[model samples]
Target: MTATVRPGLADEDLARLRARVTGPVLDPSTPTYDEVRRVWNGAVDKHPAVIVRCAEAPDVVEAIRFARRTGLPVAVRGGGHSIPGFSAIDGGLLIDLQPMKTIDVDPDQRLVTVGAGVVWAELDRATQEHGLAVTGGEVSDTGIAGLTLGGGFGWLKRTCGLACDNLLAAEVVTADGRVVGASDTENPDLLWALRGGGGNFGIVTRFTYRLHPVGPILYGGALVHPAQRTADALRFLREHASRVPDETSLMAALVVAPPAPEFPAALHGHPVVVLGAAYHGGLAEGEHALGFLREFAPPAVDLLGPIPYVALQQMVDAFTPRGLHYYVKSEWLADLPDGVVDALVDHHLARTSPLHQILLHQMGGAVSRVAPEKTAFTYRDAAFVVTVAGCWQPGDARGPHVEWARSAWRACLPGSAGGAYINHLDADEGANRIRAAYGAATYDRLIAVKAVWDPDNVFCGNHNIPPGHSGTRQR
Candidate 1:
């Protein structure tokens, strides 16, 4: 049930807002106040004055215009996975897009059009039904909007490309409150700006990405190893990563084995070096290509084999559940130095939270082939994307978890290229980090586009690039 406005908003204002949309408007006194305030990163706690659950494209337009007219901040929420809480704004308006999730497949042209709210799991299931796939977020629960808008990464990168590379078109609501369609042919500048660029341009209503014939089931899963073997595992994986074919994409995570039925009873609550993988190839070919991985001693358990593409996508979805205190930091590594691996192993053992993890994803192959200028997404030649994530409950444990993530991230930066992935980054990185992510040239172009589309900088909560930057620096 809706609550009557009591604090900042007046009764008349609430009535006007209610008249603009058919969806429910949740204020501070709403029954589900606590639940609606929650986001993927539990570390971020924001209370938007109103949460508008949009039912149609026009509702988004109305919400944008209303927020602008009333001078209230507007946050767009799809999967609520914005680590910095791009989904929620203090004393503002939140346009919750979760209800708009829908996927329409054009099998004839190998394309899939997805609503902004659709998660990776939903999209993977839909496309895999036709023996087709598109690059998506590494975690299943990641919303299509934030991930694709910020340049999504996943198991299919080496084989196909990034999520942005597969993008065919997008239906967006600009800051000026106009609905527009963007693609290579139409609004080419806007299309280029959207690629790899975070949600600085507008609130994307729907995304249409080109698809590839991936699998109904193919070789994929994790190879778990003991914590003691972490060093060896890291070295083996890094050395072998480059030699693997484009059809094979792999990543390794240092994490504690959860106390779940899927994990070994003895290994429960203990740290493990998990080498997870997915190969878009037949069993025999995948086996032949991945033979080098077996040299690190047989895995504690080999969950690898022919599994449905959708199944592989959802494999780690449960670990990163909807509402958890999450603090993540990332850097792009051109090469994994010997000392860096040792530091990572040390940090893995030092984590107080069992949910803490460090992930190293192999990037390049087809991903690197994309031109630097074609889109706002840069760093085409980076070897890997390394993310340090701390997940825990809020309260007494918050400081320790966030500190652990920061320490791990700082320790690993010396071996990195000093660039951050917009999606995996925490708020601590701030604006300077955004500049580093998109070099001088790309950032300048993005700012010009921002001036044209969102001159007032209405979408400023993300890895923001303000309107008047001559280049990457503040000056």
Candidate 2:
């Protein structure tokens, strides 16, 4: 069915839209509207005029058409995990892909075709059943679509590559209501854009990824040390992580220990530094390679050992549960300079909320071996990704939590690579930071591609790239 031609679509137009798709259409008055509109981030309180829980590509096409016809801005949701709440909009139309949760794994071809709504945990479980895997989100709850588009990183990244690197092809519903496929052979430029370009050109419905022989089990976990030893721990990590084998990946964090049963009650709620490591190789080799981390410092907690890869992926889920206010500031670092480490330790100690954390994810290996020009992700030489995540419960003052993250970010800027991981960036960082994320040349190329596929910028709800020939599309 074609869209109704009236502005501020009447109930009749909405009815027509509902008829075109085999999904539920939710409005403000609908009983489930509040629940459907809520995203993972509790801070987001947007109320879209309409929510279309799309079950298939045809439903997405109908939703986009309806938005265009009624002059409503469009927001697309997959897993509803966009940190900035990009999947929601105030008084606009939301195309939610949560119902499209299908996963098809081909063991012979080492390929997996996933619907946009499939989260990393679901994909991991399915793929692991066949002894196959792909580089997916560290937090299993993160959606495949948004993570891939923004250049995903995880424990397997050093051994394999970023999630985008494994993306072989995608099926997208473009702004003009045309269903298109992007691959090396078909619409190759669009495929290039999709490889770290954010959700600028279209709404992707499906992703096909190249899988690798990973593990049902691996040597991986974390070691926690007192906060006073943070400097020593970070310095040791910096020296050892750089020389580690390609199959080994590591991350360091300065955080307050959660009050969990695994942690000693005396240490709970105390500041601490953690060295998290994962080895994607044989158990013996992994143990030898990762053994030093466990012995580096006298830890208050030593949970490092052989663990199922799926278990490792979800280990941190308890700390990052839904319905908590989150604000993050991140930078890609070429080196972890002394000043940067000092700054991180200082800010971490000053954190107002125990839920906040300072994270440094080791990069390089296969990620850097891929030439910079091969994909839109420009920070190939970055040695690490630094993030200051400020989190608080409901009823907490927003000003202090946000300012803490910002101040920490400012302190680390001097040592930054002047670019950030696009997926880790916040909405308030604006266009200049977006340009910096992709670099000038790649950003220009993204804009050119945006002009070709979405000249009017109908898909501007993400880390948006405006069409080259037009001003920013009004949301």
The lDDT of each candidate is: 0.84, 0.89
- Model 1: per-residue Cα lDDT over 382-422, one tens digit each: 88889998888666458888889988888877678758887
Flag regions of model 2 displaced more than 4 Å: 1-7, 469-475
- What is the Å distance of residue 296 in model 1 from its true position? 1.7
Q: Which candidate is the best by TM-score?
A: 2
Instruction: Tell me how candidate 2 scores on lDDT.
Output: 0.89
> Cα lDDT for residue 190, model 2?
93
Question: Which candidate ranks first by lDDT, i.e. highest?
Answer: 2
